[model samples]
Target: MTLTIRPAVPGDEAEILRLVQALADYEREPDAVKATAESLSATLFGEPARVWAHLAELDGKAVGLALWFLTYSTWTGKPTLYLEDLFVAESARGSGAGLALFRALAEAARGLGCGRIDWAVLDWNEKAKGFYSHIGAKPTTGWEAWRLEGEALDAL
Candidate 1:
């Protein structure tokens, strides 16, 4: 199967939102997805805080997407590409759509002189871990990811 990857346009917001929800479902955290098409469109296509997205198409239908934003790396003293979410519809897996999306993100990082590309994979998702390893990506062994949520998150 042939897949094409391209930057998302304003018209693609609905499909992107669908893919994002699909990803949340796959992670068994459907409620964690608080985004609606309208909200996504506003943030992604709006000014001042635009988030970039890459879509993967197979036979002209979007089957996957990657949502990312730029971040600064104090250690490298340069920007990094942080993939906030990546999703490939179940029907489209094993057809290289995921890899195509990742390649596009990597190319974007390189073109922008990004210091690194980083993303998180759930600890229980062995398939994703294997795919990442096959692509020469390794988890930072000594570091733990932390987050603050709810009221504490709001205060900060």
Candidate 2:
């Protein structure tokens, strides 16, 4: 399969959401995603462009994506590219779609002069861990991932 990766455009919102929902399913949380095409378009193509995504296509159909944004690292005093989500459809997993997405992301990071690229992987996803290892991505030790959501987020 030929994998092609490119930045998402205004018209690709629906395709992007499909990949996101597919991701939620693969992670065993089929109903966890709440994102909609309207929201995705607004966020991805808004005036400020807060976030960016690169979509991967195989045989002329959208199959995967890397959704990310820029983050400033205090210690490094430079920008870092933080990948919020990375997913390739099950049917397209072994076709180098994931690697193509990461390579596209790396190119974006390099274009933006980002110092590092980071993202989290589920602890139980051994396949994902192996893939990360194959790409030379190491998990940061001594730091626990934390988040405030739902009631706690509303409380704040």
Candidate 3:
């Protein structure tokens, strides 16, 4: 079970989108995925690209994905790596692919001079939360996630 994690390149958009859709399904929001391969390609492989991703493979078969972007931290006076998504196919859950992907992401954050890494996990996902705890990640307290989009954004 050879596990490998590497930065995604052009032409990997289809695989990326597939993994993203799989993630959405796992999150019980199967219809919430609005991304397409074209969009992923444009955003991730275009000139002046900002979003990035890492693909994890087990024995040469794609099994996981880690997508992220850099955000500026006013307090830290440095960049922070915000992980947009991390998903491992159910069959690959215990194959160390998830941890390997995180290791790669952490290595990237350090190489890019990021002050920290941040991500959100669903409140109902005990398995994910436990895994995060095992990784020494502490949940942010005293704050809740907020979002505004679609009609609300247009009204604003």
RMSD of each: 1.3, 0.9, 0.7
Best by lDDT: 3
Q: Write the number of the candidate with greater lDDT, choosing between 1 and 3.
A: 3
Predicted structure 2: lDDT: 0.92
Model 1 TM-score, 2 decimals: 0.94
Where does candidate 2 have its weakest 10-residue lDDT segment? 1-10
The lowest-lDDT stretch of 10 consecutive residues in candidate 3 is 54-63
| Per-residue lDDT of candidate 2, residues 1-156 (tens digit) | 677899999999999999999999999999999999999988999998989999999988999889999999998888999999999888888999999898888888899988999999999999999999999999899999999999999999
lDDT of each: 0.90, 0.92, 0.95
Considering summed lDDT, which 10 consecutive residues are worst modelled in model 1?
Answer: 42-51
Ranking of predictions according to TM-score: 3, 2, 1
Stretches of candidate 2 above 4 Å error?
none
Candidate 1 residue 125 C-alpha distance from true site, Å? 0.3
Clashes of 2: 0
Residue 97 of model 3: what lDDT?
Answer: 90
